[model samples]
Target: MSTQPAPASRPFSIMPPPPPPVPLPVRARSFALVGTFTASVFLSAFLLFLVQPMFGKMVLPLLGGSPAVWNTCMLFFQAALLGGYLYAHLSTQKLGVRAQVGLHVGLLAVTALLLPISVAGRSPEGSDAPIPWLLGTMLLTVGPPFFVLAGTGPLLQRWFAHSGHRNAADPYPLYAASNLGSMLSLFAYPALMEPRMRLAGQSAAWAMGFGALALLIAGAAAWVWRPVPPSAERADAVPADAPALSHSRTSVPWRERGIWTFLAFVPSAMLLALTTYITTDLSPVPLLWVLPLALYLLTFTLAFARRPPLPHEHMLWLQPPVLMVVVLLLLSGFVEEAVAAIPVHLAGLFVTGMVCHGELARRRPAVRHLTEFYLWISVGGVLGGIFNVLVAPVVFNNVYEYALSIGLACLARPWPQERRGWRGQAMMAVRTVAVTAALLYIGANSKDMNPGLLMASAAALMLLLTLALARTPLWLALCLGTVMMYSTVKAIREPGVLLAERSFYGRFKVVEFGIIERFHVLRHGSTLHGAQSLRNPRDPITYYLPHGPVGQIFAATAPRAGRRKVAVVGLGTGTTAAYARAGEEWTFYEIDPHVVRMATDRRYFTYLPDSPAKTRIELGDARLSLARASEPKYDMIVLDAFSSDAIPVHLLTREAMGTYLDRLAPGGVIAIHISNRYLDLEPVVAALVRERGLAARVSSGPDGKRKRYESIATWITVARTEEDLVIVAADRRWKPLTDRRVPPWTDDYSSLLSVFEW
Candidate 1:
């Protein structure tokens, strides 16, 4: 290559002469750009997270009672994010600066065409298997905006890198600023935007921001781009239209691209795992998904800060041991819900993040390839998000996202290899052998395990002092030590003591919270069954309490009136199955493996009285299960299959309703619980009914204990045929639900947000 004086010293080509120096110091400009970008990030991502919970809340009513769909949507989002990242990469690679700007603006214009981005239709034709299709619909509806929004981080960073005005030494700080903005968004949106702004207002505000973004993006592009100068471009500077280079430093800390991949994988997986764990154990408050994400976003903030971050001290000291213990414990299922274990979980993540991010900073590429390096990081993240969200659900029946997270966490942290001398090796070899023997002995006898002893023994002997006296390969010793420590068996294989239960298209496993922390059970994903209420496992009334709503509805439609057949859509722990009387025939439909086990395996459902109806558990999708049932059979149909935000919108479609009505006996009552924190589902119910010319009413607030429940769930009871339900009968407690009848939803008409906060 010919000598081109420094890139900073000469023009690239036929580009215009550089503008005279402006009054703003380059430092100030850098700060403003970073700060404004950060602020924009907060605004953009805040809406992103805010909308996730809010929209989920909006649609909860339409999908049968399944919270698992939330996870499904999250998976979809991650997949789309990857798609967006790949798109950004492709755009930057194929287009010149001017074209790239034009392409982005064009995408913005197309996305704007989808404005007032509210779901307005009802009656999805293919709702027979609606989860996947509705997912596609929502994504297409929201894609244009999100795609442009996603390009912000990568595109802006690229712009700053090639600006040719500031010290290129640290344009990376802008990335940190971006995450900071995003973190603030995660916190502010739920706490502020949603609870306050109506959907139209929210949509309007986002549209305004989009317009401003377009203007800023145009301005920024105009500030930096120019035709290449023939002399300098001829000399050896990169072409004005050169592809972003993917280069690495010689002494990059991890050295392997695989390690970077591992680094990227662990944090994202942890975020998802913690989100699931909390939703499972603590709460599925869709908005709570934000907490782990906030922590993750904030980690990027600290790791990529302008200087040594706040985590440096804690990272150097406590993060290692905490990470080690948490990894071992998590791998062993000692601290299952990273959500319930927030204090320790956050601490471990914080420490591990410090080391991990510090390494990322340490190994950062030369300023020339900074943008490309981040591109790879985002690529890895998108991959992780895909694995956790897109692939995991179809693969495992139970929540194993947490297990993968533990493995990745360990992978992110390297071993302390300094002590791997000679004797240290011998000690490790002996320890490995001893631990193997102990494991074998325990396995042979098949008895109690002393997890504490095994862990302590490994820690005591593997400490650096012992290693100093002994020559060993520290990496190998630690590897064996990790195996030995991780090998310790758990005291209890099953954590939750079964309580009041129901199963939906989600997992409703509740654990004994314990004194000082009273135990409360929560559901996380889609399971076509029910839950175990800790409300005296011996008490069936909590679920099918003869004094409850089902009990009351059955009473009002008195046996004297005629024979009343019943169809319970979800048979979780089969709590509702107990509500069946001698003359009354009931069919229970359940769809999860774990739920089937909990209900009839003799391990969990000991409270149910043995009878012909007790054995009537049907395993499959509730809609399918109900569709297969005899038509015109049941007087009371309970729609509790989807009870959380991760819901399948198909169950509430007009076609599903037609199916329910076709299957219902005259004067039937359908009880649907619409309790959710993030979405306003009543509107969806209203839309569905309005489409069908049916009447409805709602019952809000907790049935009994609110704190024990965490979030309040609503019940929107509907009728297939008209009969006076002057009062709702709930467990000898006759609480009056809404009396103002609402409309029935039809396939040609259902919009969840349509009935929200109007």
Candidate 2:
């Protein structure tokens, strides 16, 4: 097989392609392609992100109007993208440019059939395997669309290279431009797109632009043959003896396949983890999820720009340990509730990303090899996707991707220059001893060690670690780093102890807000899953609150032994189980194993009365559990699966309602917590009731002992019998919920802006 083919020989170019093995013009067209290719990449990248928030809004309701739905979808998308990149690499290495374009165009055509984005019907699903179902539906629904878009950056880089663009301006700055486009999409979705457009309008707009992109892609293919012809000597070409480009003179660093995997795996994992940390801590909106990422992309732009290099390029050095500290915080129950707690985590994530991207950019080959360079980045990206979305859930409890990513980051990182002297060795000994002693002292002390004081100790130890890393043996520092890191997580991660963190495809961590105050934070990617009081000793008033949806449902109906087969979808401190009355049967369908352990563990959910009554906990998706319940006819069904931003949307579709109604007594009430920070859920509830022929009403107001942080919440109760809903909301305050005032979120139709208060 020949390395190069003249276009005439290939039958496409107006002029004959260059002779066999025509060399890339490393300097000539490099500047020109930077602008045009950058613009093209920019446009495509812009559209790629724009669609995320747009489509997220469309499907908000079927997933319970929980912002977590979007985050989960993000995980799916990232995984699909990895698939796309893999396909691109395998096909393009041997396929000619014309064939690549032809193949990519075919994919675009196939995906175009999915345009004018719309979901079938909006209702939660009844499936024991909602996550897998959700993942499958999302991948199938958007796969073709995503695969074609995902190939843009790499393909354009190839085109720029084939144009024989030979300059420092070649592919790198275009990459900066490409990311700038990504930044715009991240920023624009929340600030501009959603606020201004409806789901249909947004979909239409994206579709229009996608049509344009297809044309531009075709145009780009047409332009690849300009300025050179097959078998012709180009007089403007520089001889091989000419000075090489400045950026091209640097030696290529040796790369192992594992190293490439590390680069990709570390940053992408950190990205998803940060997505979890922020969405869990901050508000759930496209804005929240996109902000830190924008910062990350901006770092790439600044790092590669002519701007003076700050201490940024080396920030990755401290990341592994930083990651360890964050993980330890998760383990130790140290997360604070304030928004301020989020920025530090975001900063750490940004630092990790910067180091990875900066290293990639720094080691990038000359423009001649731009195609190959991006191919590796894509490789790293794809591996990261698999590691985070596909592998992490099965490999560890909770999202340890952050810690794992940090570990890999260290492995991929360039080692520090070694110094062999007594001072160095002595300093090493002091640092090593200090970290070890701290670990032992803190670990063994148990109850005596105050977490705050311990945190301070950890910080001091990390600072010492960083300082030592700067001057000592890399291996010794890393050794201490790993141990200290593990110790920190052990101290903080009370997974099965005081804090009952559910481990799975989520982050459900409980951190001590104060000595006697524990705050349980739940997460789905970058969104908060849920939070509630970790009742001290026996404070059932705040924890049990006889008026909350579940509390009211069970307390009112349980004493009568009215509903023996009650099913609760989510397990939150098992507070709902506190309403258990004698002879009443209750089963909780919870997905996270950590949450199950926390619920069943003697240390947590004590009020739940371990093995009390007929209460049973089922481990699986709530929808599936509900669907399988044949005629035990639950007198009360609580849909708690949409706990927080970690929304599993496939659980809440029109089809899902049929499953629940089928298992309900004629008058049984289904109270859905329509509480969300992003999407206005009332409209979706209204639409569901409208289509399913059920009566629904909105219940509101904070009935609990209000605190400084009493969040205003709303609920929608749908019933087979209309009177039951009124009975549930009778003593409650309610405002008329209108179709226009709220977003009519369906499985196929949801938008945050439709209901967001300006």
Candidate 3:
């Protein structure tokens, strides 16, 4: 028998009886498969998020650096993401696995032609519909590529579930990886990429990354490719006792999908609402929008993680108190500083996101319905964006969407499955009504009371009510809704508020506030943009007061001869026109048409009409409009543009300085109003002036002891020669801007974080 066996094996002797083939360890193979899918998903998310701020920055100057640019971009992205998820769901359900992979790869290849990304068109000239224009521009510029990228996470994870891996039964952890990539990218762009690379370089690098991702995606497709059906592959790879697979055969109900949507909606809405609230009301830092988004993505990461750092129950426990604290902050005017407000608002958002997204994760469907699950979640995200960007601006004034989302999040919290009896429900209803009445009463009566005392009392009562109702999500939501309603009503009924309007740029309020003399104040968030005296209608008050830095700038820059021509970048209440002399020409460049309307409306302000000079308003982004201006025509160029309290960073960069120099008349001076409550812009201006080989003087205007109407201001005047700025330089109050050795901001690279007062 041995001789027979040896004779039979003699055919292999030439190959020396090749050693038995070694098989990879099961655990090693499983990890390798999981990592490939995870990394593909991660790269998809990283590229998706990196493009947001990079492209937003590219388009920021077109929109005058309005924080709304970022909001609108978020909306666009959400909508695109929805479209992508829809495609993923339909394709996966309707097509074979190979067909799905082929279609997606083809789409990716096509979208590659659109990169490196850019803003497609100049914002339509004098276009009144900035939101529509921005949406259109973004759609044309990056829509295809972004939509392709947005779908990669869901599609790849779905593929992974069918990939015949041991852990294929549960692929949700890959979603955590996806969002982790998003969070890291958002942080990296601002801290590393932005400071080091110009926008152009970032775009190019992003394009190359996309190419690598495409190859990796192909590799993933190859790894999962099978001649057998996906069902057969899963049957061969996974065990019968796999927990996730037990529910894989069940169909998700419409009701379950609706719950998934609602759970996703609150956090999605809160992301944009919180971003708008922070950048609009607190600080308009250059990359400020990234924080809300990163936190938003982080919640997704934690909620879906295999082993979350923060437990789901813990998040639920933390949510109510955080919401109550946020409500108190909203009612009270405390925490106005960005350093404090940012963390407070971000914490609220994080907790709310945790509760909502954690619920979504808990209720996540089996691997078979993964694509459908993502589709519904994306629907909620898009709806949230629409509510904040489209619906809120139309339905309610200010950022009530933020408060509304908070209430919705309250409702999304896990509720008792058992229904309460009629008596219990009635009692809960009565208690809610009583709480509502009390909150409304306190808010209505707040005007005459000491504001701090009133806010304290109301906040205390609301906190107590919320804590009591925390066990019942429905009742807690009702109480939170009541609190928000009271806050909104109080704001609407606030004393001296004449007109409150919202635009794509920001919220604008015209109010009459004065004891001895009435003044019409144009307010943007907490910042006083400009004010006009009803007693002396032609006088420039607020930041433009006769004794303020702006006033000093006007006095120093006035031409000695006839027919001086001037250009003002920002047209806030047209206040700079107050210094105009007869026979002079003044052109105002304003980004928001609403601002132009408010400034020209005699009922609110009269600076432009009352000016003795010939005044004309130019409606567009100042940078774009100035690029079209007649070179060297302006005797003086005044940069007074602001997006709420923060000046548009583009206006303070070296490139902007060069534009001003190009537009300057011989011996002309560039006067920049650098006043800000949150940023140290003097250093930024000093850097710009030094880079341009120009002389400059900076003035921190009169002290707080000055006239009530004279708001403290800071201004910097830059000139080609010292003689051009001699008048300002001679004044002790206006000191030469010594180089602070700060890096000069360029169009390609600028970080508000670098210049942030914090």
Highest-scoring model, lDDT: 3
TM-score between model 1 and native: 0.68
The ten-residue window of minimal lDDT in model 3 covers 1-10
Residue 473 deviation, candidate 2, in Å? 8.0
lDDT of 2 by residue, 588-662 (tens): 888667677766655434645543558888776676566656757877777766544523545555666777888
Tens-digit per-residue lDDT, 1-758, candidate 3: 01111111211122123222112122224666777788899999999988988888888777656656777787788889889998999998798777899999999999888888876446657646678888888888888889999899999988877676656656788999999999999788878888788888899999999999998899889866754343534322222222222233456567778888898888988998888888777766656787888889999999888777897677776777677667756765444567876897899999989888877776665566888889999898888878888888777668888888888888887666467899999988888787666655664565568869876876677566755666688898887687887787777888998889988778889999988888888878767788888888877777787787878877776554347889999898888888898988888998788888888888888888788888888877888678777753898888888876777888877777777888888888888888886788888888887777889888886765876668788888888999998888988899877666788987677877677777
The Cα local distance difference test for each model comes to 0.54, 0.58, 0.78
lDDT of 2: 0.58
- Backbone clashes, each candidate: 75, 46, 0
Model 3 clash count equals 0
lDDT of 1 at 523: 39
Pairwise lDDT winner, candidates 1 and 2: 2
TM-score of each: 0.68, 0.70, 0.86
Residues 217-300, model 1: lDDT tens digits: 665665446442222111112322111111232222344455566677777766776676566654445445666777788878
Task: Give the per-residue Cα lDDT of candidate 1 at 473.
Answer: 26
